[model samples]
Target: MSNDVKPGRAAAIKSALESAFIALLASGVCLWFLISETQASDDGDPAKLTMLAIGLSAGLCAHFVYMAIAAKRAERNATLWVILMVVLMPFTSVVLGILLFNQVQEIEQQAREEGGAGSAA
Candidate 1:
C-alpha cells in the first residue's frame, strides 16, 4: 500500500478527527454528569455507575483515535514514535505529532520531486 494519503483517505482522516473530538466532548459531559450524580446521592446509584462507564470508555476511544491519526502521519520509525507517544502523553505527544507531520510532508515532497526528475529523464 502507498504511504501517501489520497484525497479520499484524507477525508476519512478528517472524519476520524471530527469523531474523536465529539467523543472527547461526550466524555467530558459524562464526567460532569457523573460528578454531579455522585455528589447528590448518598449511596451508589446505577445511573452514576453508567455515567462513569461511559466517561471512561469514551475517553479511551478518543485517545486511541488520536494515536492512530498521529501514527499515520509518522513515516520513519512509526512504531517507535507511537510507543514514545503513549509513554509521554499530553504535552510531549502533541509536540511529537507536529514533528511527525512535518517529516511526512518532507518525505512526500521529496518523493514527488524524484518522480518528476525520473519522468523528465
Candidate 2:
C-alpha cells in the first residue's frame, strides 16, 4: 500500500524498449548487408537467402527474449513465454507479449489505487 512507485517498473519499460531497438537495428543492418551484397544472380541463390532469413529470425527471436524478460519481471511466466515463442515463433509470442503488457499495466494501476486508498484512510 505504499505510495512510492516500484523502481523496477520504469526500468523494465526502458529495458524492453532498448532491447526492441537493438533488435530492430540488428535486423536493419542485416537487410542492408543483403541489399549491398546482392548480385543479380544471387537472387536465385538459396543459401544466401537462407542466411539472410536466419539473421532476420535471430533478430526477431532476440526481441521476443527481451519482451519475455520484461514480462517476467512483471510476474508473468518467463519460461512458458520463452518456450512458446520458440515453439510457435513470432505470432504466438507477439500475442502473448501484448497480453502480458496489458496485464502489467493493470497490475500497476491496481497498486497505485491501493496505495492511494490506503494513504487517504
The alpha-carbon lDDT assigned to residue 59 of candidate 1 equals 81
Q: Per-candidate TM vs. native?
A: 0.52, 0.58
Number of the top-ranking candidate, with lDDT as the measure = 2
For model 1, what is the error of residue 103's alpha carbon versus the real structure, in angstroms, after optimal superposition?
A: 10
lDDT of 1: 0.61
Model 1 Cα lDDT, one tens digit per residue, 30-91: 77777777788788699767868777676856755665674563323546655764577556
Candidate 2 regions exceeding 4 Å error are: 1-14, 21-25, 28-58
Per residue, candidate 2 scores C-alpha lDDT tens digits across 1-121 of 2334574674675568468658857977877766766755545567877798789878877877786777666666778877777788657656765775665566578777878999999
* Poorest lDDT segment (10 consecutive residues) of candidate 1: 5-14
| Model 1 segments more than 4 A misplaced | 1-5, 73-89, 92-121
